[model samples]
Target chain A: MDLQVAIDRVTLDKAIDLAKQLDTQVDVIEFGTSLIKDYGLEQIHAQLPKLQHAKLLLDLKTIDEGEYEFDKGFATGDILTAMGAASADTLTKVYALSQSRGKQLFIDMMEITADKTAQIVNHPAAIYGIHHAKDSKAGFDAAATVAAFHEDYPMVQHISVAGGIDLTMAQKLATQGIAESVIVGSAIVKTADPVAAAQKFMEVMHK
Target chain B: MDLQVAIDRVTLDKAIDLAKQLDTQVDVIEFGTSLIKDYGLEQIHAQLPKLQHAKLLLDLKTIDEGEYEFDKGFATGDILTAMGAASADTLTKVYALSQSRGKQLFIDMMEITADKTAQIVNHPAAIYGIHHAKDSKAGFDAAATVAAFHEDYPMVQHISVAGGIDLTMAQKLATQGIAESVIVGSAIVKTADPVAAAQKFMEVMHK
Candidate 1:
């Protein structure tokens, strides 16, 4: 029942301020893909040094050039995510690289068909992330989505869920006890008091 | 055939210098994905203005948030690329956006399967880029690869190829008459005289 707060679509200074504020409070602090593409990985890496408690996950969403992106991502943070819809070869190679480096890989299961998921369920150590695209117009019951994913791929031990998640929904997920991490982006980061909002989420998640 | 000189893995100053030298010489001056990630797109756009003769193609390799990435990419240049391995929905949205903006789309068919290729060949206006991963341990034969891709998807009109393409392979691909553009990266950019290397490639590709 860990909380991952994602900061995105903001200026580099604001993103750094938020990262510094929430570093020791949250279980994982994600510098969202927009931040990475907007500010570049090197800039983020230079601004945010080694974390004291929380893991730093850079949402790279790499679809190709796994080795180069993974190497660069690992230099800055502890975990990186790749699209599940990428070629199985690329996914497998990235997983091997992550395992070898003693880092973690979060497989973003966004827009992937069931068949594609079946093809890539062999990576035991990798975290299978169930996500609904922010732009997706379709309705998603996050808890139900996680349940279905766990049933479909029982072998995947670690799972993460994200997309439009609020504190109540996060508590529901935590009570379900299947998802290893609950990712809340705008719901927590966009509030007037992000730190207080994050604390509220932590309270509900641990209750 | 057109020569798209990809300037990658070089410092921004060096890339700007080379682009200035080859601005009017090549058919397309590509700011590669490495440069895009090394420096933000805004900086890249500000640093490298439009080419005098050639179109500027920024290889965003966008896999998700198609609208946001395309909006940002097309703001800076006339052409952008999306991963063919991306969902058909993403590709379609990006293609429509590019068409509306009077720009171009280059679909990077790097690690996609044949079935996926068939599903994505409907975008006639998009250039189907045949690229081999630089980090691939297996050998790459660019000209031969284009011949096979053309045979498989004969309906795809605009074809582009990039790998470790040399002057000889560029000439061979030119004679083959399948690919509309040949992308050469390190072979030209890393050379002592990048403009001279580009001129040699243009010569070989024309003949």
Candidate 2:
């Protein structure tokens, strides 16, 4: 399983420093939506040097104007995200664009129902991200959620799970082996030593 | 009725120039989602001298992390937007934050159903923005949509409409007296004289 580290709610300089430190430690480095909205993509793109190992994913969470956002987003990020709650037309356009550009598209399945998920699950190349909303007060069992999702939509090829993910949950997900990747935000990025925290996560996932 | 001139997919320089010119001509000046994604809020806030007359609305299109986005967004904008499709928790937090700060919140009702709308329509102070997704190829009748929305949700007091709005539609919406504001994008901003185009919209809306 791949480890995706999400960096959010920090200054651009700190985000860049964190990304550089974790570049070799993780499979994917996510510049969360807060970073994008706070710093803007132009500044982020101008300042970001290409990573030698990790793929860059910008959590654009694009709900509309998929083509425009994806086009610009692909310039800096290897993968970009759109909201699963967005229109089918929007998802289709972004998916097509991503395929054309040989990039990846992550569909953020936050606040979407199973019925809506069925409608959008046909995109085999797209990664379906399952996570609880940051604002939701509900408890989340990442492994259980992944298991249920896989059972419901067995056809979904690539699955990613997030939301308060820690080392234990990461190992559980790795053992379950249903999720292609696990997204760790504060667990890794907000730690005393992000690089060491990421290395620890890597050790557990691979153990 | 109010006229909101949506400045999108343009350079930051041109957007600022157009906003300054239309500050007195229009009721609101919108920095569209494209601009936010392209230039970012930090750059936009740094370069923008506050508008002397018109209110500035940043289309943050926030789906989660409501408090954080609203906190940062309210610094440079009098109004910031959140997705109606987001979880109720997100909507509640952002609405509360907006109220506490004495700022405004616009809920983007793009692609939401009446059932979901019923759940989120309780925020009386919030502006319920009705529009079609930019990616959808289907035609949109802005006045009719607003009229239907108003009929369906009489409790929703403040209404705003967008998507392919022109002079005729603006006049119709104004005459209907249902929508509090009509948002005009390319029709006003793409013309040879954005100020004149905005003036034309203002005349029709106020006529």
Candidate 3:
């Protein structure tokens, strides 16, 4: 299992500082959707230093104009995200673009129905991200959610789970052995010591 | 009927220039999603001169984190957009914020299922924007799409239509007496004279 740290809703300077600090501590460093919308890709690309290790993912959450967004997004990061709720044509365009460019596209399966998910699950190279909306007053059991998702669509090889993940849930998910990566946001980024928090998560997940 | 000119895929300088030129000519000046992602909201807020006549709409296309996105988006523009495909919780949060703040929230109905549309059509104050994905290869008839949408959701009073809206389609939609506004992109922004193109659209719609 891999740990993906999501840094969100912070100053670009702070986000860059965190990314630099945790570069080798995690498998992936995600500049969350808020950061992208707040700082813009051009500015982020200009400011963020090259990571010596770990892939960079921008949570673009693109719902349309896949080609244009993906083209611009790939110029900055290794992985970009698109909404699973987007039309089949849009998903196919981004997926193909990601493959051709040797980049990665993560399909955010947020607020999508099973029928819709079934339609888009054919992209083997794409990562399917599962999570409840952050604003929703809903409870999320990450391990159970991943287990159910795996049962529903066993063909989806790469799966990433996010939403309020802590160390215990990370270890549970790691033991369950379904999700390829786990995304932790406030748990790692908002702590008193984000680097140490991230290290703790890494230790538990790899234990 | 209103003419909302969509400015997309251009340099910040060019976009600001276009907005300044078209501010008085159109009812609404839209900074498209591409611009928002290319240049962050803080930069846009710092640079964009306040519109003297027209309202400004930022196509945030927000799918989640509704409160945070809307809070930031409303600081920069009169109208902010949220994806109709977003969860009911997300939509409700943005709609409430928009109403409380005395601004407008446009629910983008791109590629949303009819069932989902039915669920979200109750927000009377919200502008329901109907359009196909710009990346989709499928055919789009703007006027017809609006007509069908209006017939199905009579409760939704404010409607905006986009996607390949030209002078003829704008006139047709205006005459059809359904959509409250028609959004035109390349037809207006890509022309040799954008102000004249926007004037032509305004002429046809208001004729």
Candidate 4:
């Protein structure tokens, strides 16, 4: 399992500093949706040279104007994310664009239903994410959500999960043997020691 | 019925100039998603003067991290767009933020299915937009899409439409009497004369 450290809700200078610090250790460095929308992709493109060793993933969460967003997003990073609930056409267009650029697309499934997933499950190359909403009023059993999603759409080979994942939960996911990537945001970045937190997560996930 | 002239895919200087010119004629002056991503919201916030007559609508096209995006978005414009395809939590969070700001939220329904629409049809304050993707392989009949969507989700009071609308289609949507707004993008902005094109569309839709 590759460790993807997601940085969010911080100033660009702070985010860049943390990214530079973690680049050599983490496999993927994600500029969370907050960074992209707050600072904009143009600024990120200007300031992202710090990510020399790790792959940068911008959580674009694009739904429409796929070509425009994906084209600009790819200019700034190695990977971009789109809402799986985006139009079939939008998802397909971005996926194709990512493929053409030899980059990666992470399909963020924040609130999409099982039926909708069936429609978009054919993207053999894209990563289908089982994400719990950040602002959800409901409960998020990340491990259970992954198990249900896997049972429903087993063909969706490259799966990822995010939302309320701690090192314990991350380890549980690893032992479950489904999700290829696990995304933890505040649990890591908001900590007193983000690098130490990430190292602990990496140890648990790798175990 | 209000007219919103959206300026997109132009240099920030040109967009600002157009917004200034169109501010007097239109009810809303929109900086489309292109401008936001290209120039970044911070830059646009610096360039955008407080509109004396028109309400500024920045098409943020936010798909996740609703609170952060809406917060940043409202700092610049009177209205911001979130995809109907985004999680209910996302839509709800942005809607609340918009409500608190005493601004508007335009929910773009570009590629969402009917079932998805059922899930998001409860926000009476949001303007439900019926849109066809620019990257769609098949032809999009905008009036037809709006009429069908209105019939299905009559609870959704305000409706908006976008996708290759010409002056003729604008008149047709006006006569159809469902969509409260028709979003004309490249058809107006890419024309040899944008102001003339916008006036012609306004005349056709309003007459």
* Shift in Å, residue A128, candidate 1: 1.7
Docking class of 3: high
Model 1 DockQ (Cα-based): 0.52
Query: Across residues A102-174, which tens digit of lDDT does each residue of candidate 4 receive?
Result: 9999998777777777889888999887774444545457777888888989888888888788788889888
Residue A70, candidate 4: Cα error in Å is 1.6
Clashing pairs in 4: none
Put down candidate 2 lDDT per residue, B1-207, tens digits, no spaces. 988989999999999999999999999999999999898899899999999999999999999999999999998999999999999889999999999999999999887777788999999899999883344445547766887888889999999988888798889888989999888889998999988998898888887
Clashing pairs in 1: none
* Candidate 1 docking quality: incorrect, acceptable, medium or high: medium
Query: Model 1, residue A129: what's the lDDT?
Result: 89
Instruction: Please provide TM-scores, in order, for all candidate models, with all chains considered together.
Output: 0.90, 0.96, 0.96, 0.90
lDDT tens readout by residue for model 2, A15-65: 999999999999999999999998889999999899999999999999998
- Candidate 3, residues B1-207: lDDT per residue as tens digits? 999999999998999999999999999999999998998888899999999999999999999899999999998899999999999989999999999999999999887888998899889899999883344545557766777788888899999988887788889889999899988889989999999999999999888
User: Which model is ahead, 2 or 4, in terms of TM-score?
Assistant: 2
Tell me the tens digit of each residue's lDDT in model 4 across B96-161: 889988999999876677777788888899998776444454545777788778888889899988
Two-way lDDT contest, 1 vs 3, winner? 3
